[model samples]
Target chain A: AQRVTQPEKLLSVFKGAPVELKCNYSYSGSPELFWYVQYSRQRLQLLLRHISRESIKGFTADLNKGETSFHLKKPFAQEEDSAMYYCALSMIGDMRFGAGTRLTVKP
Target chain B: DAGVTQSPTHLIKTRGQQVTLRCSPISGHKSVSWYQQVLGQGPQFIFQYYEKEERGRGNFPDRFSARQFPNYSSELNVNALLLGDSALYLCASSSPGTGEKPQYFGPGTRLLVL
Candidate 1:
C-alpha cells in the first residue's frame, strides 16, 4: 500500500517570500509523484509531475527517494499561487493523495 | 474538447438506498477512475477502469461497485448507502497507454445522505 502525507494542513506566507509545502510518501518500489492545485471556485489541476520535472507557475518539486519526500517549493510566492495543494503517489495502477495543504499568501 | 463530465451534479439519498453516478471521460481517454472525497479531506481511490476492464480497486467494500462502458464512460453504484457515504464522488480520466498521463478530474457529484 502507498500513502502520502502532508504535514502542514495550512501554510501562510508573505507575498514574494519563499514557500515550501512538505510531502512524504511510503512505497516499496519506485513511485511517480505529482503536485495538484485547486484555486478557489476552480477544479483541481495538475501543477507538475516528477517525471516531467517542468516548472509551472514558479512551482517545482523534486522527488527524494531516500527521504521519501516530494516537497513543493516556490522561490517567490505570488497571491495567485495561494490555493490548496495535494501531493500524490502513483504506483502500479493505483494512485494515492495526501490530505492537502492550504496555502495563503498574505500581502 | 470537453473535460471529464459527471452527471447529477448533486444528489440526495437516505440510508439503505441505492444511487448511481455517471461519468463521461474526455475525448481519446481510455481510462476512468473513481474517488470519494469527504469534506475537508483528500480524495480516496475507489476504482479504476481501463479499456472497459477493472484494472484496480481501492479499500472500498463490495457495496461499492463500478463499471466502464465501451465508449470509456463509467458509473459508480453504491448500494446500502450509509451516512458516511455522503461525499463528493469524483470521476477522473486519463490516457493509460500514454504512460504516466495525468488524470483529469470532474467537478464531482455531491451526494448528501440525510
Candidate 2:
C-alpha cells in the first residue's frame, strides 16, 4: 500500500535555528510529493511540490528517490513558520497524506 | 477568482442520523474531491468526481456517497452516522487533464456526531 510517514509529531526549534521536517514514503511507482501547511485559524494550503522544485517562504524540500524521502528544510526558522505541516503523495486517482508534524518556532 | 466553497460551516447530529454536505468548485475547475480531516490528523481522501462522473473513491463505507452536478458542484451524503464520523469535511477543486495539479481546498464543514 502507498503511505506517507511524518515521524515527528511535534518539532520545536528556537528562532534563527535551522529546521528540518522529515518525511518518508512507501510507494511502488513514481509519486508526486507535496508539502501542505496549515496555520492557526487558516485553512490548509499548498506549500510546494517536488515537481516544481521551487522554494516557498524560504523553505525547500528535495525528493530523494533512493531514500524514499522528501524532507522539508529551512536555513533559519521564523516564528511565523510555526504551523502544522503535512506531507502528501498524489497517485493517479487518490492522494495520501501523512499524519502531520506540528512545528513550533520559539523566539 | 473565488476559491472553492462549502456550505454549513458547522453541524451537529446524532448517531444513525443522515447528513448531506455540499461543495462548489472554483470557477473553471472541472474536478471536485472530498476529504475527511480528523482533529490533528491529515485529510483522508473520500471521493473524486470529474465532469459529472465518479473518478475515484477512498476506503470508506457504503454509507458515504457523493455526486457531481452539471455545474461542477457536488454533494456528499452520509447515512447511519457514527460518533467516529465526526470530522472536518474538506472539499477541493482542480482542473482536469493535467498531471497532478495542485488541489485548492475550501473552508471545511465541521461535523460533530453525538
Candidate 3:
C-alpha cells in the first residue's frame, strides 16, 4: 500500500519567516510527488510537482528518495500563503494525499 | 478553459437513500476521477473513468457505482447512504499519461448524509 504522511496538522509562522511542511511517503517503486494548495474559499490547485522541479510562489518540494520524504519549503512566508497544503503521491490511477497541513502566517 | 465543473455544489441525503453526483470534465480532457474527502482527512480515490470506460476503482463498496458518458462527463452514484458518506466529493480531470498529466480539481460538491 502507498501512503503519504504529513506530520503537522497546523503550522504557524510570522511573515517573512521561512516555512517547511514535512511529508513522508511509503512506496515500493519510484514515486511522483506533488504539492497542492487550497486557499480560503478557493478550490484545490496544484502548487508544484517534483518532475517539473519548478517553484510556484516561492514554494518548492524536493523528492528525497533516500529518506522517503518530499518536504515543501519556502524561503519567506507571506500572509497570503496561509492555506491548506497537501502532499500527494501519484500511483497508477490513484493519488494518495497526506492529511494536509494548514499554515497560518501572522503579519 | 472552464476547468472541471461539478453540479449541485451542495446536497443533503438521508440514510437508506441514494444520491447521484455529476461532473463534467474540461473540454479535451479524456480522463475523470472521483474522490471523497471526509472532514479533516485527505481525499480518497473512488473511481477513475477514461474514454467512457471504467478504468479503475477504489476500495469503495459495490453500492458505489459510476459511469462515464460519450461526452466524457461522469456520474457517481452511492446507494444506502450512511452518515459516513457525508463528505466532499471532488471531481478531477486530466489527460492520459504515465507521468505527463496533472489532475485539475473542481471546487467539489459538499454532501451531507443524515
Candidate 4:
C-alpha cells in the first residue's frame, strides 16, 4: 500500500522567517512526488514536482529517496504564502495525498 | 487554453439519491482523474481514465463509477449516496503521452448530502 504523511496540520510563522513543511511517504517503487497548493477561495493547483526540481513562488521541494521524504521549504515566508499545502505521490494512477498543512504567515 | 472544468459548482442531495457530475478536460488532453476531498482532509483518488478506458481505480466502493468519452470529457456517477459522500469532487486532466505530471485541476464540485 502507498501512503503519504504530513506531520503538521497547522503551522504558523512570522513574515520573512523561513518555513519548512515536512512530508514522508511509504511506497514500494519509485513514485512521482508533487506539491499542491490551494489558496483561499481558489481551486487547488500544482505548485511544483520533484521530477522537474523547479521552484515555484519561491517554494522548493527536494525528493530524498534515502529518507523517503520530500519536504517543502521556503527561505522567507510571505503573507500571501498562507494557504493549504499538500504533499502527494502517485504511481500507476494511484495518487496518495498527505493530510495537508495549513500554513499561516503572520505579518 | 481553458483549463479543466467541472459542472455544477455546488449540489445538495438527500441520502439514497444518485448524482452525476460532469467534467471536461483541457483541449487535447486524453487522461482524466477524479478525486474526493472532504473537509479538513486531503483529496483521495477515486478513478483515472485514459483513451476512454479505465486505467486505474482507488479504494472506493462500487457505488462510484466513471466513464471517459472520446473527446476525453468524463462523468462520475454515485449511487445510493450516503451522508459521508458529501465532499468536493475534483477533476484533473493530464496528457500522459506528453507527461502526466502537474495535473491541471478544476474548481471542483461541492456536493452536500443530507
Please write out the lDDT profile of model 3 over residues A35-94, one tens digit for every residue: 989999999999999999998999888899999999999999999999999998887767
Could you give the CAPRI-style class of model 4?
A: medium
**What clash pairs does model 1 have?**
none
Docking class of 3: medium
Docking class of 2: medium
TM-score of each model, paired residue for residue: 0.98, 0.98, 0.97, 0.97
Ranking according to DockQ, highest score first: 2, 4, 1, 3
Model 1 C-alpha lDDT per residue in residues A1-107, reported as the tens digit of each score: 57999999999999999999999999998889999999998887889999999999989999999999999999999999889999988865688999999999999
Candidate 2 residue-wise lDDT, A1-107, digit = tens: 99999999999999999999999999999989999999999888999999999999999999999999999999999999999999999987789999999999999
Residue-by-residue lDDT tens digits, candidate 3, B1-114: 889999889999999899999999889888899999999998898998888877778899998999999999999999999999999999999875432268899989999998
lDDT of 4 by residue, A44-105 (tens): 99999999889899999999999999999999999999999999998786688998999999
User: How many Å off is the CA of B53 in candidate 2?
Assistant: 1.2
TM-score between candidate 1 chain A and the true chain A: 0.97
lDDT against true structure, model 3: 0.91
Query: Candidate 1, what DockQ?
Result: 0.64
Off by over 4 Å in 3: B96-100
Stretches of candidate 1 exceeding 4 Å from the true structure: B96-100
Q: What DockQ score does model 2 reach against the true complex?
A: 0.71
What overall lDDT, based on C-alpha atoms, would model 4 receive against the true structure? Answer: 0.93
